[model samples]
Target: MDANQQVPSEAALLGLLQQFTLETERYVEAISNRHHLHRTDLNALAAMVAAAREGKTMTPGALRAALNLSSPATTALVDRLDRAGHLERRRSEKDRRQVHLEMTDSARATGSELFSPLAGAIAPVIDALSPEELHIVMTFMQGVIEATMTARKDAALAEPMRPLPGT
Candidate 1:
């Protein structure tokens, strides 16, 4: 290719893939918001519900790690969610020092109802893909997502300080 000519490569393909993924997420959020939940709150509640469903419990420390948040940030998130009646912290039966995070009944029901249609719409598409194709696509998508996440972390760390509007 000449200097001005472009050659399509894996990077170009991944860019298109990422765009589609983000668009799908935006669409899902728009649809879910019709049911009265903001996308971020829904995501947090869903995460807590999934962990409970999978027989895993999250402590404040685990949540901090999972969200890549500091202890104070995680505590604030937990407090807000708790006050919203979406989740509760309980003393762990097996470990006294650890508090297990659990989704409240209302949150679980709301999440399930909000997501059921979205899940139904995607199920057929997923089912149509062959097992091998699904695995390959999932693996590639995971890799792309991980790379994007790491890049975001690095960018945040390297961000320049901004001056106040009038200062």
Candidate 2:
């Protein structure tokens, strides 16, 4: 870099990455508030809907792992969403004990209405990128996600440890 154009420091880049996630979370919070849902509940519903859109089945156990919640808490979460008419639970055909979660029609509509605007806004920004640029962005995001997970694990190792929220 020229004297007038300094390379970005790792700390500065990390801050930027963190701020992006943080701000996105604040946006999620706002959407959740509008829907009278907890942020975690909103996230759970969103994940279920997204998975369903991709023709994937989301088991309650898988959701527990995904959300890092305890079994009882996951059950409670499933119950809450079910009661709210945002989600439904179904027993596995092969294994009755295996519970699967899916978003209800109301959830599908509300989640889409709440989240589609942000998707629409970002579409152009993503569309501006070439295929190679998109790949690079995906690779970078995967690396960042892995690094964040590792950091969380390391932090947990350093602590006495508590259960995940809603657990």
| The candidate that achieves the highest TM-score relative to the unseen native structure | 2
For model 1, give the 10-residue run with minimal summed lDDT. 35-44
Q: Specify the highest-lDDT model's number.
A: 2
Candidate 2 versus the native: TM-score?
A: 0.79
Report the C-alpha lDDT of model 2 over 1-167, residue by residue, as the tens digit.
67998689999888898898898998888888887898779879867866777898999887888788999998898889899998888888999988788778898898889889889989999999999999999999899889889989898689576788998
Clashes of each: 0, 0
The ten-residue window of minimal lDDT in model 2 covers 43-52
Give candidate 1's TM-score.
0.67
Off by over 4 Å in 1: 1-12, 49-55, 68-73, 159-167
Per-candidate RMSD, Å: 5.1, 4.6
